[model samples]
Target chain A: MTSIATAGASVTEQHAAIAGARPWQRLVLLAVGLLVALGLPWFVYPPVAMDIAAWALFAVALDLLLGYCGLLSFGHAAFWGGSAYATGLIAIHLGVPFPLAVLGGAVFAMILAVPIGYLSVKRSGIYFAMVTLAFAQMLFFIANQASSLTGGENGLQGVPRSFFGIEAVETDAFFFYYAALPIILLGMWAAWRIVHSPFGRVLVAIRDNAPRARALGYDVERYKLIVFVLSAGLSGLAGGVFAVSHGFVALPELHWTTSGEVVLMTVLGGIGTLWGGVIGAGLIVMLADYLASSGFDGIGIVTGGVFVTVVLLFRRGIWGTARHLWLNRKRS
Target chain B: MTSTTPTPRCALRTEGLTKDFRGFRAVSSVDLEVAEGTVHALVGPNGAGKTTLFNLLTGFLKPTSGRIMVFGDDVTGMAPERITHRGVARSFQITSLFENLTPREHVEIALQGLTNQGLRFWRSEKLLGRRRDEVDRLLAEVGLTELADKPTGLMAYGQKRALELALVLAVEPKLLLLDEPTAGMGIEDVDRTIELVRRIAEGRTVVFVDHNMHVVGQLADRVTVLQQGSVLAEGPYDEVRADPRVITAYLGEAHSA
Candidate 1:
């Protein structure tokens, strides 16, 4: 995002650099990660890769605000879950094209978040986190209570996977994986661009020291709002993908636990580092899947335990640790 | 120096600016009119509300009871960014800059304000243009061009101060406010800072709050001495230096410190 092409760092250069790096080189490690992500499904099942991709994109959205902007939202479930049900409803009720419906659902999520984010951004620290959580919980209850519109706890089912005219998006495990891969990749690419831009530099400035950013003549509120909307919109994209992949959308999609899970993914991947979010999401989701099949009666307890341990011992997360190691290696 | 003492439509004028914190006056009943193109100095001892006055003047502190006029517009309690947009950019006493960013990056972000590129991350020209030229020139002006690509956190104290000055000047404001631009610098850096400030004030209007009498004397065309939230004395640096009340009230505190 911060790279000037005239100065250099166009989206093409970024992609090319990723491609051009000598495989194990530093400049394209993230590119390597994405390549592995594309191929990782071969080793694992397609559904598993698709699930990780969706959650990874969602977690990246969270990382954008929480990690980069220094704003930790406890209500991202509003984007994730709300978009899921909304996409489901539009697909089932309006009979709209899947791609268009998902876009509409994303727009819906962005709009819904305006007031909540507006008011919440007025506060800082735990208050900001709590306000977002409260809004998310409110969304959860609304989803549950509006059973007629939402199909209650059972959620809306039988969502058409055929997004737009593309019949390739049906609920087949492999097809769904391929269908979601591009969107997820695009989301990650866009996010990576945003964070690397000069505009992205200002967000970090706002996070690191807001008073200074303001003193430098930045309308901090405007920057925060724009990114908030963008993050929510991308998260909404992930939600849309989720609904399409499963052929169902339920009220639990908006639940606070879902919100918490995204937050965990962001933090566990090392909040503020873009690639960390994806790594964290994949690790956690893969762990959850493993534990679920292994008859681990309480996945949350184990997940929670690991989360605490990571927070205590390795606060930077796996990706952050890698970056740290790389920086050190170069310096020495 | 050109003693024109620019009076360009009263670029930054405050009428009856007052601020109270918890029933105590931090800055009270103060009126200041800085001409459009001369360097004005606001000098006083520590704990005499110099920073508080700076905060109020820069819109960081809301006046309990007064109007702050910038470039002849009444912007009494407007937020800092609005005031800054209206051409009243300032530098912090502590050199508030993006630590992880290079001086080039910091200056570019500041330039984004002038170019109207807020929140449009993907369309930034930060690494090029008159923007970089301006940053480089300003860095050169403040003797920091050699370190333009260095991260701010890694710069020497003097270089950081110089970078902050470059950033403040980046907006090309009608008035520039410096809050202790020379604080905590070694004698050589302080001398260099005064030289840079004096060079820039030749064409720009400035009102800085500082404690160093030497810096104040070397740069100020006119001086305003503040003590306990009110003006103790206002005149040429020589006159303010002679005033007994100014000494007993503001300078006396510096003596104690």
Candidate 2:
């Protein structure tokens, strides 16, 4: 009994020590990451890189809600696709610059998110997810039926990228990549800051034991709503940027399948770790791209198999599992 | 009996407090008053509505057709957090802690609320280093300084109880509702906890429910015994213990043991 007790104590100490990354290590990793992100398009197709960055931002936004806040939203496509359509519409009709249009789209998506999030957060677990999914379906229906605004099935096309009042990025993928990279990085930084802040600590507490947090004088629902809105705004930012980068907003952007895809990305990369979402997004996007290029008709089977293996063997997702193993190895 | 004519300083009071689940009344109309700076123990047999009354007082459950007044302020139907904000904190009968968090993290989270920094998202948590001395003092008080960095899940049960008490004290609450604070503990742990409670209740008003009669007999300044869903007897521990209804409530279990 004494030996068992000692073992438990040591394991807990090691776990606590490994829970957070050291500041200098995080800084070094961030620097290396930024350099790789800046040079990534030079090696791969710039458009694909841009896609990865946008989806990475979206996944990070979802992670803020799903991972940190313990909220599983199944209708994030509303923010993504809704903002994409809004950004495309503004660019096509109002002749606004890309930055303003993306901002406008993001703001519009946040406006939509307020009511949806307010209602959805009132429920929890599968009910919360279903409510979000229901709201997204509603938005999808609106986008499809409003053919004059959204272009129906054909989607909103001919979205000109007016870069800083100059149409320099209209046809240049590299210019678009440079422009989108900073926004994605900023979003990533925001998520990291939130997770490290006092507010973030409360979020984790709520995630762990909400009733206890409430008893400790935290307005748990208010915190959940704040995170939900923040996640939606970030997601909208990604969608708006994606619309500008691609110069089009398709109906599929708002589809439930799109929401599922991002969820898959977050889970596959790792859930709670902020960078896990980015890695998951990159992996899924790359896998789908490769499958499409190789004429693999059964991409779903392969992806499903990968997901099953990850769930069974590495439940913490790729990054979390890796960190856990590395920490245990170091301890031993 | 001659009653004193002094104005009673009640820290917490319930007026016709009742709770109904569907149609079944778990706690019938119950009026309770806990005076300021006293450790009041509510004792009852299993399912005698002790936990439910504790929940009603702490704002975990809304009272049906009643008012909960804390220091003369009617705070009925308020959210649990709001009640906590108004200087009430509680612990569960079962250990309810963030299993993944270290004892230090649990205290820090509670301190975040107490220090009014719970909403500060942009600042680094290390800014709370200013209060490191206070956190250390609290941990030391509970004799948990050695296990401060350990995750709560890995701590021995007695350590978790101490940690929970430290967390409850972190709120600097005027009223504390501790549900079975020393429910399942060894004799050493129970004695230590009784001492800890006695020390902490120096200025604060505490309402606790416990199954351990010895701890209650030692710590409670006054005792209220519940039968079914109503208070059957109220007096000093010895006086309430001798009450026929109170004894009958625990007759089979006490005699068997």
Candidate 3:
């Protein structure tokens, strides 16, 4: 038998190297991100900035499943909106602080994700998307019919924001933005930690080749379900914050369109890059706010045009493509 | 039939194993026994159920009516991962790997399975640094030490195949089922793989399917020849190669090709 060294230089190594972010690059990106996040409200309207923060978290949460786990969910609105309603009810009925209420709603979303993810993870690609979409639509119908509990078409309004019994927020959007920023930032940090963890590597393995992962002794379905639940809980955190910040949980929150919008934001920013989603959420929210103020009813047309361009031109999404180029240049 | 009949120590055994796909029998009633600590090769023409048998042994497919036992425990109809837990590991005929992951990452993921920490999403991946020595050993064992940090997508087909073998070795299974360990390889890679398999097969039972007779001749301690999903002959490689039925089966496949 020959030792491996002698077989030696006979084998050819092919294919382009996939770029990885170094520790310094990640730290620098994080610092820049913190600066932008803190300085956004100073430049933009406080309400719009609040929407950006909430939606950014939502997009990051969705990207956890879609980009990392390779599971595309078309009905994430269930968790986002479901958490909003749960958070609103908890705040209004229990009179707890906003953070406690938000945490409670996020937990509720995780519980809901258990069954949906259980059934949906068995499926792949378009079928998985359809299963999630169907479940969200069913929840939408139920919320509309529950009338008294959900407040029917009018939604749950006057969802007060209290900070440990001290009315610090006091129905002030600007003040609420600073408080919610930490929670949203926490959710993003959790998402980042997950993708860089051992479990996240397994999720990527499963995404790359499920049967192969199974042969390696990992439970592919269980991993998928775990990530799905985690993503939902994080999304719920964002939705809960959005509800209390706006002091309302409306029908549009649960609508399929909201689900579509978040997907758009994640893809536009970059599906697998956690930061890409924040950039995406920020871009879409700011664009929509600007368009609405300009009395531009065709906001969809412009957003749709941009989405088409991104899909056609920058297939890896904004942040993904940028990082790819940056890494390639560094290598050269 | 006698009470004094001696049973050999077998690493894997199948009794009346059969698989039917919509009334078409891919594998007929097949009883196979592989003694412990040997290289066993399954060779047949295309569509003769060689891969199917490998799949059956690995729990990738449930037999229609049969029993599969590994190291004396019945693993019939068990899940693929459960079969792995029972000290059986397999490599795919086609290259199956995480394209974006590095070879080191691949070995780490497989090594993680041995521990209960694979699901620790909250802990840093740097914790896997504890297994750094073992991971390096596996990568170097397969001659991928230099390219260990490169993503598999950028690797040659042969390098990817070598990585697959490394992944299987990381589990340190008692029995290894390799499907076409040298399929679609250049002459040099094929020779390298043959020597590599010979080195790795020490003290472990190996069951592999290959179209390359050279690989079979060089590595197989025993050969089981299949024809139309049934065992046509079984003996040492030299004896099996001399059998007329085995020769005819090979000739038949060659003619068709």
> Which candidate number has the best lDDT?
3
lDDT of candidate 1 over A1-332, digit per residue (tens): 11110111122232233334474575477668767877877887777887899999999998888867888888999998888888888888888767777777888889987888898888877788899999999989988889888878888878886655666556467866876678778888878878877668788788767888888788888888878888898899889888877889878788889989998888788776777888888889899999988988799998899899877777677766665565557557
Task: Report the Cα lDDT for residue B89, model 1.
Answer: 87
List the DockQ of the predictions in order: 0.44, 0.63, 0.55
Q: Write the per-residue lDDT of candidate 3 for residues A1-332, one digit (tens) a residue.
A: 01111111111111231235457876897899999889988999988998999999999999899877888899999999999999999999998989999999999999999999999999988899899999999889999999899998999888989986555565677777888899999998899889889998888788778889989999888899999999999999999999988998998798899999999998898767777888899899999999999999999999999999997888668977776676568668
lDDT of 2 by residue, B195-221 (tens): 999999988999999999998999998
What is the descending DockQ order?
A: 2, 3, 1
Which pairs of residues collide in candidate 2?
Answer: none
Interface RMSD of each: 5.8, 1.9, 3.8
RMSD (CA, angstroms), candidate 2 = 4.2
The better-scoring model by DockQ among 1 and 2 is: 2
In candidate 3, how many Å is residue B238 off? 2.1
lDDT of 2: 0.84
Task: Give the poorly placed runs of model 1, Cα more than 4 Å off.
Answer: A1-31, A163-168, B1-8, B124-130
Ranking by TM-score: 3, 2, 1
* Candidate 3 residue pairs in clash (backbone atoms < 3 Å): A14-B154
The DockQ score of candidate 2 comes to 0.63
